[model samples]
Target: MTKPFDVKIGINPISWSNDDLPSLGGKTPLSVALAEGKAIGYQGFELGNKFPREPEALRAVLAGHGLELVSGWYSGRLARRSVEEEIEAVDTHLTLLAFNGAKVMVYGEVADSIQGTQEPLYKRPRFFHPEQWRDYADKLNAFAQHTLSRGVRVAYHHHMGAYVETPADVDRLMSLTSESVGLLFDSGHMTFAGGDAVAVLARHVGRVCHMHCKDVRPRVIRHARNRNWSFLESVINGAFTVPGDGSIDFRALIRLLYDNDYSGWLVVEAEQDPVVAPSYRYAEKGYRYLRDLVERVPLEAAREAA
Candidate 1:
């Protein structure tokens, strides 16, 4: 029987090539990543550094591998820039997503993010005043409204070193922003921040337009916290991995989405050393695990309905 919701499985190229730390899989070609991902049964892929910038070129490249363009990350500086300036900066990226038939765009607040730096996670910049939340949300509301007009929704990514990292921070942002600003729910980052991923999702599932099905190793996270490791340092130490390979309970997560009638791409994204976790092997494992979990949800839902 057909499922009641439309939940497509996709993967981010970060598992094969780390964008922030390019040296990890910098030698691997984009073609290889696409081919391997397609072989693993992912319906699509998120944008990566090696992807073609031109719309037509990128379309052709993905088409060749029988994959769709899920979405691409946009480093938004709305925390420090005007809504108009933010819109201007995102025009090309918005155009690419729209032209490629993508429905959502990943927007990560990078105005003061330290995820890319060697700084410790605890050293991340914080919102100094309460008014900062109102100001940032206003800008996000405007930006998201404009992007929706261009045929793509904005999914705000609350990253590890960004201003909005914890569950409380996410709650505040969601409360402040209009519904136009959707959330890109990431399981790994949420878990890494020491928040209950399921509980957080339960509170804000309605605003989830996209999701990153990333998993976290609790041991690595504990070590990182104990030793004051940077975000990248933790990633290098195998803090993140594909779902089912780590401690996350994807079955519960998928069931919740299905119960909520969620519809969008669930992307398997993990920034790990390709050498330690061979891309194809790990990617295939994640794909199969999520596929089974997603498929099982509808059956259970049907039984409940019956």
Candidate 2:
């Protein structure tokens, strides 16, 4: 048997957040995920951005569920904000995350838009730009500095829309960043965005701070490419799933992580499926599948090595 990395399964709120949308209550789905996470034997969770912003209240909810806060999503246009302003926001969120023993901050870059037309659409990821890379790097450096100053770590999430998604993009990010600013790799999104996790992790092993253990459906990938599906839309359309249940080769992926000495958490990020699949049933099935995959991954490595 192969040794294991210190990993924890988590759910992204986007899936469960929409559960009690308008007519229904909103908190039900999220509560379900937290409860199910603990009941099914997960050690920690990445609380979604849409959770109640009040840190104390959020802490209470987490305590009730028996889940440790592993990490969380935050938004801002680092290009426009001053470092101090960003630090303030980081401090606030970090306090909540820290209170629950979270060590990593999942940074989501959102373009702040006013009701006015001058501000750009915040939800979409902007196209890649070299200058933007430096600005992003600078922003991350500043945030990482501030986070560390507060005694926490920050992982820059190169998510689908917010400017860092490709292999080259991840390259630029790691090259520009200090080790304090680490990679939060999402296997499903990497492959979905034309990135090979196997290759990318090989290049930046030392800088990977955290991970998301989700996987993608190849048929959905085919549909996504053929139909020009947006990343979020595809996620909403049942394109992502549990690790072994999807097309990703978790054995190779985990082997790479093991070789890299990845001692951080393996967050389970399935944004859209939680709603379509429902939190209780979806999380229960996902937990068992991922746990099994985690257990089997190392044996594959030992077999190959032998």
**CA lDDT of 163 in candidate 2?**
66
RMSD of each: 1.0, 4.0
What TM-score does structure 1 among the candidates reach?
Answer: 0.98
What TM-score would each prediction reach against the true structure? Answer: 0.98, 0.84
Say which candidate scores most in TM-score.
1
Best by lDDT: 1
Poorly placed runs, candidate 2 (over 4 Å) = 1-4, 19-29, 112-129, 273-276, 298-306
lDDT of 1 by residue, 1-306 (tens): 546768899999998999999889999999999999998899999999999999999999999999999999999999899999999999999999999999999999898899999999998878878898898888899989999999999999989998999999999999999999999999999999989999999999999999999999999999999999999999999999999999998888888888888999999999999999999999998999999988787888787777
Tens digits of per-residue lDDT for model 2 on 1-306?
Answer: 566656666655544564313222255566666666787777777776456667788778878877677788767567668787888766677887776677888876666322112222234455456787787787779778888776678777776655676688788888888888878888887887788878887888788888887788788777866776555556656777766667788777777877666887877666554446666666667678777766776677678778
Worst 10 residues of 2 by lDDT: 112-121
Question: Where does candidate 1 stray beyond 4 Å?
Answer: 1-3
